[model samples]
Target chain A: MPLNDQLPALNREFIAHFGEMGSRWGINRTVGQIYALLFLSPKPLCADEIAESLEFSRSNVSMGLKELQAWRLVRLRHVPGDRREYFGAPDDVWEIFRVLAEERRRREVEPTLTMLRSALQETPATDDERHAQERMRQMHEFISRLMIWFDDVQKLAPETAVQLMSMGSMVTRVLEAKDRLTGRNTKKQSSPS
Target chain B: MPLNDQLPALNREFIAHFGEMGSRWGINRTVGQIYALLFLSPKPLCADEIAESLEFSRSNVSMGLKELQAWRLVRLRHVPGDRREYFGAPDDVWEIFRVLAEERRRREVEPTLTMLRSALQETPATDDERHAQERMRQMHEFISRLMIWFDDVQKLAPETAVQLMSMGSMVTRVLEAKDRLTGRNTKKQSSPS
Candidate 1:
């Protein structure tokens, strides 16, 4: 069926919601809706197909796909007889979780850690500023360690992440154990655990 | 002192990095820089103060302040006898994390869940289409449950979040164990163990 006829009003509303969500996460609304549509779609779709379905410009679809590719949110496919490229999300939702975790850590956490490192090296102007820099250093180190933990997490099979997602409150229990193991009670520890 | 003179080059570099990061996250670059600056500042700053320090337009500062307020990223302060509001990040970084989780869940996750619910109610045209709707149903339910878990996590005290952040790999290990207990072997289970 033609997409316009096949896609109901609910689909459009869902796509629009996703688009708005994309803006919150530092992506455009169109990109979010496009990805959401791809996620719901059973088959890989080409740029023209996506543009037509979403009522977006061809160039806009092109750019959205490009950005999605950079974020590793979409996969490219080539039909056996077709010359055009197609795009789709991974079948497993866990894969999306892994991608989001890894991408956010890279885009947000890593840079903050890097900044904290540089800031720590700078000479403080006075006692008060020195204390603030010290706090920044603590934040940097803490986040760096967290990133390392996430690196270990990414190594877990997609199935493993899926398992963890459903673990619920037990996740918090394990975190508590980890705190005791690390010997870090408060956020600021004078020395490494 | 001029910002160039008062703020070290490294500080400016970090601010610039955050500004760029903001664009990637859908936040205005100046707003990101302003937040980064606030994160590091020893004292709360007024909009005029931020404008003067960053050499940005006063109007930009106003818009940025509004955005920051919406994000719950900046704390409004009242200095003794002063009517002008001062803004700063929470003393604890985990507080920032909690606010981020809550706000994003409310703005992004809840709306998506609503859309998914509506989509689930739509009648499928055929058996194969029914199967597709089933997949979406699983996705929608899982997402809704996950949002609840995040809400629980967000309600946690900052001290607890910091403890978890500091736990590093141990938290993952516990989650791994929890995954085992939850019967995570299946590809898609509507009711997770």
Candidate 2:
């Protein structure tokens, strides 16, 4: 089937959006497009199939698939009587979200924390360095605490996670109400209970 | 103060990680470092201060500042008696989060939604397009509903928002449990709400 005839408007739109989002997330345009294809595909698609369907170079598809695997975004399947592998997205979007958050925290946040820890060890003789280190300490501690909570939230029931992610829009309002109700405007001192 | 003396380990780590994350998030290395600096600084820093302190090129600093302003990541301030403009980040991280979320939704999600809407207007007559469109409808509806929930989450109480963000690691475990308990294995029937 002709590519255009096979991919409806909705699919095209999805592909385009995913492509753009990929760029925002620091991935290449083609990487995003391939992911979108896998996401919308009902059955597993091989590298060649994806390349041919998307009209992208086989090497590009190969590279994108490798990165996707690194990110744990795609899974491989073997068709009976066939040696080649195919790819598919996980069944749950929440799972994808989990992988994304975890991967980012690991890749971006955790390493930074390590560096901050070592930096905090150095003594400061001057007020400027002292002040700067103070700021760094706050950030390190704050991010660390937040990471702990993320670990905890990940353990919550799936319904709870959905409720929380859905709470994205309502977050500020909730904070405001909590402020008025508790008279605590700064960070919460919620200790382990 | 000399840059070496002023840059704490934490700050250095932040700069390094932000530089790496910048590429992932579609921003430049220097730009991310600059934002990291702004984020931790108690007072606004001038272009010269930023340039001298971070050791980035003047032109790069200029471009980075322009981009930061466009993102609303920093605000301009003038000393009561001075003409030099200082740039500062919002004190509240939640505010920063709000801005980032809204901006990303606009830049990434909204455009995709627009594309999907336009694509949905076309009819899917063939099996391939029919399958593709069906998947597209599912994804489009999912993303749309998810964004609505995000808007709601944005308005959530600040403390609640922090509490939610703080969930960290627990986020994954809880959702997994919910998946098993509810037997919500399939994507078709699960409403994000």
Candidate 3:
């Protein structure tokens, strides 16, 4: 398929912008473009279609699809009676978000957590070392707490997560109510006194 | 100062790892190393000290510091009776997180929002274009909602945000309680019934 023939100007612009945005965020430009094309396509697209539509080499499309698959950002499906593999993004945008979050946590956050833990295990031999260890401890604790909260949030069904997010300021109000029920002051604390 | 004299072996390892991590995340390795060094330093470090400690060229150190300053991730300070400027990370890790979130929103998220908005304004000339516009609308709505929620959270005192996060599973419980109070079932909704 001719790229200009199939993809309208608006679609082409959006795909190009998406590709640029992806590269800025550490994703490969071609992979981003491929994902953008598949995301907007109403039907699953085979590798040949993606290559032809994006004007990317077959090898480039293959590599991009492989990377997307590894990130779990795209799904592979076999169209009925068709032997070639087809790729598509999840229908729900939230599902795409869930995959991105989970993958980032696994690839980046988990390793950082490990590094912090190991640093904490090393005994400090000097005042400077002691101070560094303290800093690492704080970092580790903060990350640990965040991960726990994230895991809990991830456990919620996607629809429930959407409902909870839709709550918006109501969630803050709920926290305030909890504080009131526990008899803790909601006022900002500026000092110990 | 000697390149390897003041920094302990553990510090060297940590700083090196941080540089690697930074590169993986689209940050320059030198910048990451400089930031990590400053983060663990007991006092603000001068450019010469950072260059020597990290074994980086003076020019590289200068460029890295400039980038860090732009990101608002490092502070310039002058020690008493000292002419040269020194750099340090914020004492509070949470403060660093706040700066990072703010800077990312300003640099990356806001521009993408603009692009999505512009795409949404264009009239679709075909069903395919219409579907693509619909996808863009979902993305724009999701991002807008997230930014609003983030702005609200950012307004919360750091301690309050920590408290809210520390609530962990209790947050879900609070949401369930609110739903119950409002006479809504807590069962997970797979679809609108």
Candidate 4:
């Protein structure tokens, strides 16, 4: 194969793998491929260019772009001296991560939280129903706490979040040091052992 | 509706909602429904019981159980004097979360890390390829750091993790306090501004 042929082949491999990975994360293959293409492109690409390069139908590309836009994963740009609308992924990977986390929380987590709250409002009239309600309460509390923490983390500057993440388990050491200074009982430490 | 009828109706609604939610997370509807059913059950349930309760075919229940087991989201138990296999979710919701995180890390994250590592090994033949390679490296590093942090958190006792999560943004405040004590420059605070 020519060098040019090899390059597209390699790009195709990456695109295909991304599509498969996206399916595992509840995204369809086409959208994943489109996002992968945009992410790897050196410049913004118009719909026609994307359709031609990926050999997707023009309509398919249009719909995929719409989906990507709804997810806030792709941005629209207009090139100088060009009338066509072009699409590209954000240059910063951390921005993409932040958008994904925020969108998923909005679309998936919030609805479940609503459901749990409504379920908990009902009075249980039987032993079985009471048991189920209790389970739901436990689930509700767990999800609520997680979302609270997530919301706080989302508020952090991406760089700060990165710093905290890079600290890894060392954050635990810091927490321990604070506890020692305050003379707080670290009873929970017993559970990990 | 009769009281008995009303109870099952409510349970069914929760199960159906969970199935939908599961699909959004890349789990098939049947597996999600099965797991939800088991999670709410006060006792371990046999395959026949599961099939009858969910009104699914026996084979469907079997396949769902297999998938759930592979995900490590469900466990098998043998009842006294019974030949049939019974299934149940972990009694503790946190334990379920731990299993899911570990299994996904093994099945999904590890493979992607391997791919990124191999992709990085090949020298880029052009400027565009080099830029793409650079983006790939950024993605790889971000994912690796995340996995490291997750691994550390996972090692913490569930109680400790809960405590940490409940602290929410207070943890960030703690970090800032530590920074002041150590005189570290917090340049990233401007990003969120």
Candidate 5:
């Protein structure tokens, strides 16, 4: 039974869009489609149901689920009386976001940070090396600062994080006011957009 | 002359690393190598120097520079009296981050937002459609909030932004204190991991 035959037009379109977007981001198309379908599913779906819904082969569905689990994008469950495992996306969108941000930091960012730290530790034997080392230091410092801030925000309850984002320039205003009092605004970092 | 022969060991290693990373991110290996070489040069470098240093063909270097310029990763320059064009990365790492962030948002994030908006606009004709629409609404809301925060922060002076990040959860504390005073701390968004 092809469950996709019963899918609402909107569901097909939504799943298709995510399939395209996911492929662009290095995830395979079938994996993206499976995740999108699972994401919008009103209840947990077993692998067979998943295959039928997306018209994916059983093996493909299994592999896609494995990839999604590796990305922490989906969770597994045992439906009490059923012998098959069921999979589902986290209910809260914020939770999905946290998993993605943290996972990407682990996969993509950690490698570069590791490379940078090692590069910075090497003693430069030439002027070119010295200049490159300076650039690396700046890169490492900025990324580390950004990551620390990320860790702090992720620790906050989602509501608190949302509130902070909505507060907008209120935080920057505080910095500006402190700068005014301390006369620390002399040097400006200008960037042409 | 093969300028790669003159490359400092550190510079060679740095260029090699970026080349590998770039390919993983969809940018080609040669383009990444070209950008890496230009980035480390003490002065703006012409296409010939770039080709020689990366051991890339003349056509490859030209194409890479064009791609880099499109990504806004490198700027085109004219040497004082030389007819040949030179290219260089922005001297400020912060500025490079800004360009990369903005470019990625334009290329990747905007399309998803557009799709979500369109999906939300369609009238739901089924229960499945209704559920899918609700999910799309949540996605749009969260992404819009994040983009707004990014815009607000990008408007700040680099030093101010650095100060804000280094403040390390101070902003979250303000929200926490407010929640405590308002008696609005009851509904927690629980997330696993």
Candidate 6:
């Protein structure tokens, strides 16, 4: 039942592509394939079942599952009579997206930001060093700006976030309207009697 | 001077860190170092200069430049009276960021979207297949929503986009205002009808 004999062609293809794409990203190929398998399985699968279904070694499957768990991409469960633990992906794709985004920001973006901050704190000994520090400041500012926006989006209720995203290009009109209102206020404050 | 005798310690540290970080990313260590060198150099540099300064082989330098060029992360120029092409990154970090975002979307996200589309087109033969298809549908919809928002952001003039991102969490207020207006209109249209 856990994708052993009749792993549909659709699921197989999906799993295979994810493996290939996973290597391109930070995740290893085997780990990516393992995640894809868990994601598509109709029920939580124990280690042995996953190993046999994907034709991977038991140790390999175990390692992949451990990696997936660290990514928060898979969850573990236990059956009533069975000693073995099973794993499955969260059912909600948006949850998966949120986890991936947050993890990447934490692991990759945060370190880069720290590096940039330390670089900026140093006093430049030359004009060229000054220029480099300036570039680092620009990079830092851009990432910080993005993080602030992302934080706001992260705070929104999932449905509201979806609604906001669905608004898409229409959000620009709202921006424009806000700008007009702010511009008029500034004009009124500056006008002479 | 092409940083032969007086490569700043600041530049050296920045280049080394970028190389380390770049390997974590898709780019190779040497290539990332090379790009960092070009990015911080006061002027465009020739292959020999890059190779000698970085202590990398001419061939490694050549390959790295080629990779950077493909990413549109570097530009080629000719110094007057010098036949060899010189390389430099865009002076504008925002331009570099925009190019990176666009290139990544085209290379990674677009292909995944296409794969999802093809998978969605296939008919399911069983309940299990239907469940797998449903998950795929959810994944596709989530990515599509993100893409729509990203596309609109990409279309904004760079300054405007910067301002919008700079607005940070304030953008949510706009979202709330838009929702209230739309909610009132719907109420009016349906009231006592």
Most TM-score-accurate candidate:
3
Candidate 6: chain B TM-score equals 0.83
* Worst ten in a row by lDDT for model 3 chain A: A184-193
Backbone clash total for model 5 is 0
* Candidate rank order under DockQ: 6, 3, 4, 1, 2, 5
lDDT of 4 at A70: 98
lDDT of 5 by residue, B1-193 (tens): 2337779877777788888777766687788888878777888999988877778789989888888999999988897788999899988767788888899899889998998888888999978689888988877887887788678667654654355434444445444443444456523323211
Off by more than 4 A, model 5: A1-3, A158-193, B1-5, B158-193
lDDT of 1 by residue, A16-122 (tens): 77777777777887898899788877789999999998888899999999999998999999999999999998887767877877888877787777777877889
**lDDT tens digits, residues B97-170, model 1?**
66877787778777777777877888987664565576578678668656665665554434554565645654
Give the Å shift of residue B51 in candidate 5.
1.9
Candidate 6: misplaced stretches above 4 Å? A1-5, A158-170, A176-193, B1-6, B159-170, B176-193
Could you estimate the TM-score for every candidate?
Answer: 0.80, 0.78, 0.89, 0.88, 0.83, 0.87
When 1 and 3 are scored with DockQ, the better candidate is 3
lDDT of each: 0.72, 0.70, 0.79, 0.75, 0.76, 0.77
RMSD of candidate 4 to the truth, in angstroms, is 4.8
Docking category for candidate 1? Answer: acceptable
Candidate 2 residue runs with Cα over 4 Å from true position: A1-6, A159-192, B1-10, B158-193
Residue pairs in collision within model 4: none
Measured with C-alpha atoms, the lDDT of residue B185 in candidate 4 is 48
Per-model chain A TM: 0.80, 0.82, 0.87, 0.84, 0.83, 0.84
Per-residue lDDT tens digits for candidate 5, residues A14-121, read 788888877776788899899989888888999999888888899999999999999999999999999999999987777788888888888778988998899898
For every prediction, compared with the true complex, DockQ reads 0.35, 0.30, 0.40, 0.37, 0.30, 0.42
What is the C-alpha interface RMSD of model 6? 5.8
Better of 1 and 5 by lDDT: 5
Write candidate 6's Cα lDDT for B114-136 as tens digits. 88889899999999889888888
lDDT of 3: 0.79
